[model samples]
Target: MISKDEVKHIAALARIGLDEKEIEKFSTDLSSILDWIEQLKEADIENVEPISHITGMENITREDKAEDFENKDGIKKMFPEEKDGYDKVKSVL
Candidate 1:
């Protein structure tokens, strides 16, 4: 179990203000957390494998394909506003 002095030291390190009741509550909470960690240490993980992720994925590479078009005028016509054959937006700054 956590001690009163340890709780006070932790509060000071964290720059927190704690009254007697808060200190006692924190001490109990920290003890419970530590107990949980101790229990987890007893888990059986001897045959378990370390993995970055569980899902399987294929790393397939593909050649880049390019298709040329002459739709500049069509694109400009769909724009909200166009000036000098180019789309225009509100200026920043």
Candidate 2:
């Protein structure tokens, strides 16, 4: 069972502000989660092998290629501001 003080301490460590009602609610929720964990502790896993992923994933293959667009000038003209053949922006600082 999780205590109210424990819930408050955890909330403080996480930089969360919780009222009394919220603290009580979280205490109840955390206690239920702890109970679920305790139940999982008794599961049988003698033949279970540890795996990084549950499903098999394969790396997708693609052609190592580069292509140029047909409308370079049209794309360049879309920029609102440009300087010296490059996009321009106002100084931030």
Candidate 3:
């Protein structure tokens, strides 16, 4: 069983704030998840072959072709703000 302290430590590492109720709920949830994983570990799969993907689809790729940009000035003019040949947007941080 997962302890409340372990859940609190995990929340601290993830930098998320959880109340007392949430911490207790997550402790049970995480304990159940760990139990399920342990059951999966006990499964016998020695004869099973490892598969990368269930869908039998091969890698489909197109030939890389360079296309000339005919409307460079027109595209640049569409931007609301441009500075030093680059688009200037608001700072995210």
Candidate 4:
């Protein structure tokens, strides 16, 4: 079972501020979660096969193919400010 002090410690570590009510509630909730996990540990699944995904889906990605832009010069002309061959913007730092 999770104690109130343990819950408070967890809240502090996570940088979450919890009131008295919240601390009490979390203590019970955390204990219940641990109990549920313990119950699951007793289940037998020796014959079960591990699966990556429930829905079988294959990678449908297209091959990477580099192609030159048709209107490269035209697009460059649309930029507000251009220095050499690249766009010039305000300093960020």
Q: Estimate each model's TM-score.
A: 0.44, 0.46, 0.46, 0.45
Q: For candidate 1, give the lDDT of residue 86.
A: 78
lDDT string, candidate 3, 2-92, tens digits: 9999999999999999999999999999999998889777779999998899897899898899898999999989889999878899998
Candidate 4 lDDT tens digits, 1-93? 999999999999999999999999999999999998898777898998979997888796987999999999999998899999798999989
Q: Please estimate how well model 4 matches the true structure, expressed as its whole-model Cα lDDT.
A: 0.94
Over the full model, what C-alpha lDDT does candidate 1 score relative to the true structure?
0.89
The lDDT values for all models are: 0.89, 0.89, 0.93, 0.94
- What C-alpha lDDT, on a 0 to 100 scale, does residue 21 get in candidate 3? 100
Q: Candidate 2: where is the Cα deviation over 4 Å?
A: 44-93
Candidate 3: deviation at residue 16, Å? 0.8
How would the candidate models be sorted by TM-score, starting from the highest?
A: 3, 2, 4, 1
Query: Residue 78 in model 2: shift from native, Å?
Result: 25
Residues 4-92 of candidate 2: C-alpha lDDT, one tens digit per residue? 99999999999999999999999999999888888766889899886887676767789989988999889778778977777788888
Off by over 4 Å in 4: 43-93
Q: Which stretches of candidate 1 lie over 4 Å from their true place?
A: 43-93
TM-score of 2: 0.46
